[model samples]
Target: MLKFRELLVQSLLNDKDEGEEIEDEQDVPIPRKNAKSTHIMKKFEGNARQNRKRCISCYDKLQKEKGTKEARAKTKRVMTYCDECDNKPAMCLECFNEKHPSKYF
Candidate 1:
């Protein structure tokens, strides 16, 4: 299966470059596709791999959208698992906050 990042990049590549520069007051074309790709690339440009780590909650949410029973349950419960948490690989934000308020403080 193609990864989401790969798909996004591929889509950006497949899109035609839009716009042309005009010297006068004529409409100047801005390369929206290039700008969009740059915006997305900027999101993943930083170091600190941890920052690049995918959000488990977000992944689970996507899975739920795709109709996974387990993911659905997780969503209905309004929680998500995060490996950074002390216990399980997943835990909802509310539970994490409740359990680790001191850590945050």
Candidate 2:
């Protein structure tokens, strides 16, 4: 049996995401990008099932970030990912630092 750490190292070196190898003895195969999409879709499904809505802060942030020059409170707050970082819970340092201490980074 592969040791846990060895397995992790193997995964890192494998260069392929484990989620991408969606297959079985049936010889069916799906690439990792599709697998990642499936995973995200499932999470979105669950969120939809719960009728989730953005928090006040998140809603405000969306409005501010997406607002045009006319800048008004938008009735629909569409969830968007950060184009710069694939929206993985990131804040640009220039804006984040004034509010959040550098140590948090």
Each candidate's TM vs. the true structure? 0.22, 0.19
TM-score of 2: 0.19
lDDT of 1 at 55: 40
lDDT of 1 at 87: 42
lDDT of 1 by residue, 7-94 (tens): 4575678653455322342333334333222211112234544333334454466586775655554443322344343443444454
Per-residue lDDT tens digits for candidate 2, residues 10-76, read 6779965767752343453333333222312111223543543333334456668886432334433
Query: Model 2, which residues run further than 4 Å from truth?
Result: 1-29, 33-39, 42-50, 55-61, 65-105
Q: What's the C-alpha lDDT at position 75 in model 1?
A: 49
What's the CA error at residue 65 for candidate 2, in Å? 5.0
- Native RMSD of candidate 2 (Å): 13.6
The lDDT of model 1 is 0.42
Distance (Å) between predicted and true CA of 56, model 2? 10
What local distance difference test score does each model get?
A: 0.42, 0.38
Residue-level lDDT for 25 in candidate 2: 36
